[model samples]
Target: MAAKKNILLIIADDLGRNLGVCGESKIKTPNLDDLAAQGTYFDMAFASTASCSGSRSVIQSGLHTHETGQLGLLRGFQGLHYFTTFDHVETSPKVFNSLGYLTGIINKVHVGPAECYPWRVREESSTRDVAWTAQRSAAFFERAKEEDKPFFLTVGYIDPHRDLTRGGFGNTQDYPGVEHLPYDPKDVTIPFFLSDVPEVRQELAEYYSAVWRMDQGVGMLLQELHRAGLDESTLVMFTSDNGPPFVNSKSTLYDAGVRLPMIIRTPGCTPGIVNPNLVSFIDILPTFLNWAGFANVKGNRKGRSVLSIMSETSPLDDWGQVFGSHTFHELTAYYPTRYMRTKRFKYHRNVAWQLDFPFPGDLYGAVSWEGMRNAEPAMIGKRPVANYIKRGPEELFDLENDPEEVHNLANDPEYNETLLDMRKALEAWQLETEDPWFFRDGISTRVIFNHIDAGMKMPDRWDFDVNSPGSKDGAIMPHSFKEVRGRGAM
Candidate 1:
């Protein structure tokens, strides 16, 4: 048999499909564009969740946020530790290591319990120093070459994630000999998810600057790989954890948030093909394993390898729809939502429709959001302020006509069938996944089971507070600290 192919999976933080190859004229990404030209660029790739850690966890584990229990960030201030990964979970690194491939990761190690992800080479940092990272990766590549073993190196960059300031995207730093082609606010194209206010324009300009730097990083890494003569033997994949780091995009279930840029350059595969299949981050684990000649690596995962579809230029019949589950952004931002998106319709089921949508810390403090929030009635581009925050239980959008998702067709008489069908699909998925927060009558079914599992009497009306017993209505509230603590309902 031929030599096993190596893997280099580069994940960009908080980046959307706004690259030059993806038809965005504002930013310059020649290296990534060239890669797209020399590889297969996927148009409809998406993330299971929009948050950083949760999305990364999904990609690594081939499991949804609900399944992995990494529903939010690993940061402590948020008290979202309840959603952290359990020890029993299997990760890509674990499988790769067991298969005798030298697994390594450089920078931004966000997801984990340490034991689950046993990467042989773990260089963790949160800096956006791309050149420095490339040098470090070069050292790792040299080591891999010396070892004579096929390697799996994951390079996670901190580019394009929001900086400390509202309008900064890590552009102030000066890297050696790196030409920072600055973006003009006037020249930047505004995405539909945000209003075209001065603040938004300014922020987008900074964002473009960060994206440019990230593209430079990509160029440097690819150059290093070619120099080491590992380019052809490697299956290189470039993608992002989630969407852009802007309000209504990063934490939302909309395409602007979950939809990402995915380009794969597999060894001996046809290049420059655009596949518009509905693929997700979860599909990546299987693809990596399959490409590494370990297709049957032991793991129970929801994703399947897309190696067959990677070379296809036209859309495939089986690649029709995708599902998304986002429970929390922060522990405080408890908006349990699920979605089923097809070519024409996108359906969203917001479980806690009665409560107003919570804002992420970064988005809440953003000047762009301030501009829209202080506007007449505060509109997110064309969407109403009320619609942005206070959503109903169900929402359906005809993406073919209303690509911006500004119009809701859930209540429309013409779309009742579509709405019902999508709702049923989402409900069936929730049941299959055994989601703890599968809301029935504002009550989590798993919480009801908690009582049964605990050997406590099942409430007749299901009207006992999980918090204070006999307080009426055994509701499992996420933000209610006392409730979740007393009831042990995550």
Candidate 2:
């Protein structure tokens, strides 16, 4: 005879594991620390994509970014809506609204096409006023009580994110209630991927200030839930959209970009368990579905519910790998990349490797980038400026040996078998996901299915070889996209 459980999902924009719980950050996130102390802190949770809208859409849809059609930013810095979630997609808000729950989103509605989300109380804005957001959340809880229905509320806090420029992270505004916890540039912890330069530290200090502000928002949002007397019956989760809004972290497919901090507080679960299970952002919607008593009725979602393993403290054999896709960040930042990350290895298949990787508009304008650009020979963290810019088509990294992913083992003869095995495994995943980026000879094989069926001979190589292109005899015919997409073939 238990009451129906409510769900509160708080998404922090452009955040990383720079908190007290991670024990790696100099930034003090007391509220998050308190939450992790009473919740399951996932050690290996990852984002489906490193871009904002792509990752958030995966979170809401329980599908990969490629499947959701939310390929990049729905709203850019200039207030333009570009890549939105398709109308055909069944997002979490739509799903919960279809059920009996009252769904509402306050602050930062990154995923869009209003018809697709169908939020009952959608007040989407980028106001950095934490107090106002908390006030709205309190009103939402009261309204849900008045309507006599269980609720699902998403409080999107835009903090720790880069401002319109890179000079500061959303830290210029003054608020009446939130405390001003300014970080000293010298004391902040420098990310391993990014640099140890003074300019990066200055930006990190500003980023820490923004994080403090965002932590205040979390503290405020949770206070409202407690004041509403809905504490014990609510499943609260705190996480970020992607990684930190830095050069190498935000829009890239490396571990610094995709690996994120995840903390979930579920009712009736034992508190303070540090779970090491490899979870994906896509798993969140399925977790919500399982929480709403609809686990048996899942559709084409690609993730399993993490609710069953919230208390686990060690990595499970089955949950040892994750996959990701990143095609765009803004409307113009197009560099199609897909990856398969196992427990110890990561394989990146950059389809458009010919084009130099694009920078996010905001990151490009940041003061940090300016400093790096002016350096005698610019570099990003441990990587050289040239290495970070122009990349090879395939990259394989043994994460255990090279945690920074600076060393590419794709071409190394010592790991030839490992390289081949990873490539085949990644291709199989691309087949399973029906990714259009599956290429052969510089062309997407998905689009050439008809020509392939018409008996046009093609090379078996991933990319077209200029030295010896013709493969009339050795060409291995691949299955059609229709067959593979329908789960009929692999």
Candidate 3:
């Protein structure tokens, strides 16, 4: 058998399909572009959630937030959102380390309990300082070479996340070996998820600059890999934890939040192939396991390895829809949502639709939000202010025509069958995954733990009526009640 391959996993923070490889013309990501040229690019890769910590937890444990019990940030200081991984779960580093590989992580260390990820080399540096991070990685590479062991190194870049100061994506910093390629607000491409406002443009420009810095870091790492004579033997994978840190895109269940960029260069595999097979971050652990030659794959893992389809340029028939679950981003940003997305259609079931969705701290205070917050009726993106804050119980979008997700077809009778089928599939996935937030009337099944023995059976359909059993009183159902369970809903 061929010698076990070394794995270099580079995870960018808060980046979506904004790289040069993904056809973002304005932003410069040449290193990633080159990586794509020398590897396989996944056109439809997705993150389980849009939150940084929660998404990283999903990536690490190969389980959704619901399964892993990591609903939000690991900030115990605030008290409520201090969630962590389940003790029983095996993280990526743990699994790789078990296979006799020397594992290391440089830059941001968001997901942790420390015990779960027992990386041999843990260098937490500022991801904004790409040159510095690359230097640390180069040293790690050299050490791995000297150790004569297959290594699993994760380079987590903090670039592209919202900066502490509003409208700054690390452009003001002075990195010795990095070029400050700040984008012009006039040249930046405004995503449909955001409104065409000057503030949005300015923030995007900074975000682009940060991304450029990250690209430089990627180049440095690749150069180091080549210098160590490990280029051909290393399996280099580049991806991000979540989407952009913009409001309506990061925390929301829309495609802008979950759809991500994924480029993987496997040793001796076909180069420069753009594969369209639907893939998820959950599949990453299994892929790593497969690479490490693990025979008995763990049973608790929820994803299939895409090793077979990595080389093939065509999409697979079996690669159907992907599912996602999000409980919260922060303690107060509690919006339990579940979704199932196919190539043509997308369905979302917002469990806590009655409660107005809370914003992430960074986004709330961003320059991008200035237009939305002060605009007439508090606008967010292109949607109505009220619609943006308060979501409907169910959302169905025809992605074939409305890729931007501007139009909601949940109420339209024309696509009733599509809505019903997608909803059914989403529900089936919920049951399969044992998602706890899949409760009727938005009454969290977790809360019913005390009442389960008292004949409080989990209802198939939630009763939106305030007077009904388990129904949350004084809560407004955003959508019309015509398609509810007893009315005409599937």
Backbone collisions counted per model:
3, 4, 1
Which prediction has the highest lDDT against the true structure?
Answer: 2
Write candidate 2's Cα lDDT for 1-490 as tens digits: 5476799999999998887887765787889989999989998889989988888899889888788889889977576548988788889888898888999999988888889888899998788889899999999999999998899999998887777765777677788897878888999888888777788889989999998899888999899999999998899999998889889889999999988889999777888888887899989999988887889757788789999999898889999888899999987789999888888999999998989999988888888888877776788887887888999989999989998998888899998998888788888878777777888877877777666666777777777778886776656466655554333321
| Model 2 CA deviation exceeding 4 Å by range | 79-81, 453-456, 466-471, 474-476, 480-490
lDDT of each: 0.84, 0.86, 0.81
lDDT of 1 by residue, 206-283 (tens): 999899999999999999999999988999999999899887789899999998999999777787889988998889
Could you tell me which residue pairs clash in candidate 3? 441-462
Q: Candidate 2 — which pairs collide?
A: 166-366, 194-381, 441-463, 441-464
Order the candidates by TM-score, highest first.
2, 3, 1
